[model samples]
Target: MTQLQKQRILVVDDEQAMRELLTDLFEDAGYEVSTAADSFSMNRALEEKPCALVILDLRLKGEDGLMLARELRKDSSIPIMMLTGKGDETDRILGLELAADDYLMKPFNNRELLARVRAMLRRTTELSLPQIRKEDSYSHQRYSFDHWVLDLTSRELFGPDGAVESLTYAEFGLLEVFVQSPNRALSRDQLLELSRGIEADVFDRTIDVLILRLRRKIEPNPKQPRYIRTERGLGYIFTAAVTQC
Candidate 1:
């Protein structure tokens, strides 16, 4: 790929050896690679370089990577993957909650890492492609649904009373599915594939967690979600009529 077309990757790890290894790997993959040894340096790199992807290690002296990931998600949608050796279910899930796109345990295969990098980049293609047709009922009139107000021209979600809501890249995808299907019952597999962009062999819990989060903001009563409903074994249902003015 030409220099202009190469993906820009930022490697954030305090270990010098690990940083060199990742920088080499990404450069071999025809990417523009940059490195940071800590959060301060990482932020400095981000300010100076236009990074398309970030490979972040979860541990560092004086700062935690999970904390770094949260701060990054607050402003940019740059894809993030967490590298960690800690093996705990709760920690993995919490990393996901903080908006890391994926995680790999230490001693990960290079091939697997490459595959994930490609998948995350491939999702960029959908942003350029034409959106699929939505149900006729989906509209953006004078109203509020969930925590968002409608942005008519852009058709993006806004905060209630007209402020812009800070939605992560994945959260926007989930909202897109609901807007398109409104009032339809979609299975966990369907939600995972349709919204999260995972191809196959997806664990159902991912969709469940996403739904739980979306409900907290969108539903009138999160405990008894009006926009999203559980259909027992059947899956989930979104019940909203989006209308435009």
Candidate 2:
């Protein structure tokens, strides 16, 4: 790729060897790479230069990578791919709920990592493109449901009182899928494919966690979620009536 076309990626890991490995891996894949050993350096790197994606390690030296991911999500919509240990399933699930876009278990294949990074970058680029097909209901449209307004063009959500609600990149994508197909039952596999174009494997549970998080944000009562409801053996459904403008 030409320099103008090369995307930038930030790899945040405490270990030097791991950081170097990832930096080399992504750089060889034709991306501009930056490395940060901790939150301080990570913040500095982000402030100094913007990156297309952030690959965050779940375990950082004396710092909680989950907290860093949450902080990043709160401030920016930048895509985050978490690197996690094999036994950190709870942490991995929590990371997703906190809106990390994707996660890869430790000892992951380098090719798989590159593929995921490409997929994520492609998704983000597609969302930000100025020109989209007008006939595509999911693109450049505003969807209203249960007093909330979702503006796909601006990628923002407005509450009933007209306050802007903060949604991470992953949350927004999943919510968009639901609003576009309101009142339809979507299984975990379908939701995964529709939202992120990933298959349902270990990520089926991740879908459930994301649903729980979305309910907490949009449903008046997450405990008895009126907007998104479970469909018994059929996964979940968006029960709210959505109108598009």
Candidate 3:
């Protein structure tokens, strides 16, 4: 297949051997692969070619992966899979909070890695198809809630002040789910099923983290969320009226 026709994936890791291994693995699986040892190289590659997803290491030579992940999410909704050695619970939760779509431990199996890459790419494609159709069918593709506007095509959030807010892929997915079902209490399990497909390994806490991130963007006060209110033992509900344009 032509390079341009293949799905491209970027691997950001400082380890040379690991880079080669990942490149070989992805290429063997019929994907175009690019490697970057640091943020600078990663940025250069991203600027040069569109990437389907990024496999970022948690630790770089002189940089932190979490920080880089946050920086990437601030502007793009590209799926990120964090690679970490420590496997600490805090790091896992924090990575998810930063909108890393998924993660793998250092000693990850190659098959598992392949499975994750395929799953993430599939979900990304599924999420994008609706936006494309909406853009073509509607004059203005936006979802409004509580004076805030979310551009469905651009995946952009605009506040009442007309300022843009950055939302990670997961955060946006959760928000979309809520907006489509406002006033109904959705449990974490239901949310996990709806937003992340049928991925059973997805934790319930991840839904909570995604909710917190979404509230920070849509709620007038994240501390006292008027739109997304917790239902105590049940879960959370989007109480605000949503209008689609």
The TM-score values for the models, in the order shown, are 0.80, 0.90, 0.85
Task: Give the whole-model CA lDDT for all candidates, comma-separated.
Answer: 0.74, 0.86, 0.84
Q: How far is candidate 1 from the true structure (C-alpha RMSD, Å)?
A: 4.8
What overall lDDT, based on C-alpha atoms, would model 2 receive against the true structure? 0.86
**Which regions of candidate 3 are displaced past 4 Å?**
126-143, 150-158, 161-164, 243-245
- lDDT tens digits by residue: candidate 3, 35-94: 999999999999999999999999899999999999998778899999988868788889
RMSD each, Å: 4.8, 3.0, 2.8
For model 1, which pairs clash? Answer: 139-242, 139-243, 139-244, 140-243, 140-244, 141-243, 141-244, 141-245, 146-218, 183-238
- Give the runs in model 2 whose Cα sits over 4 Å from its true position: 131-139, 199-202
- Model 3 weakest lDDT span, ten residues long: 131-140
Model 1 segments more than 4 A misplaced: 125-155, 199-202, 243-245
What tens-digit string does per-residue lDDT give for candidate 2 at 69-127?
Answer: 99998888899999977666787789888868889988888888899899889877876
lDDT of 1 by residue, 72-114 (tens): 9888877888888787667667877777766777887887787
Ranking by lDDT: 2, 3, 1
Candidate 3: clashing pairs of residues = none
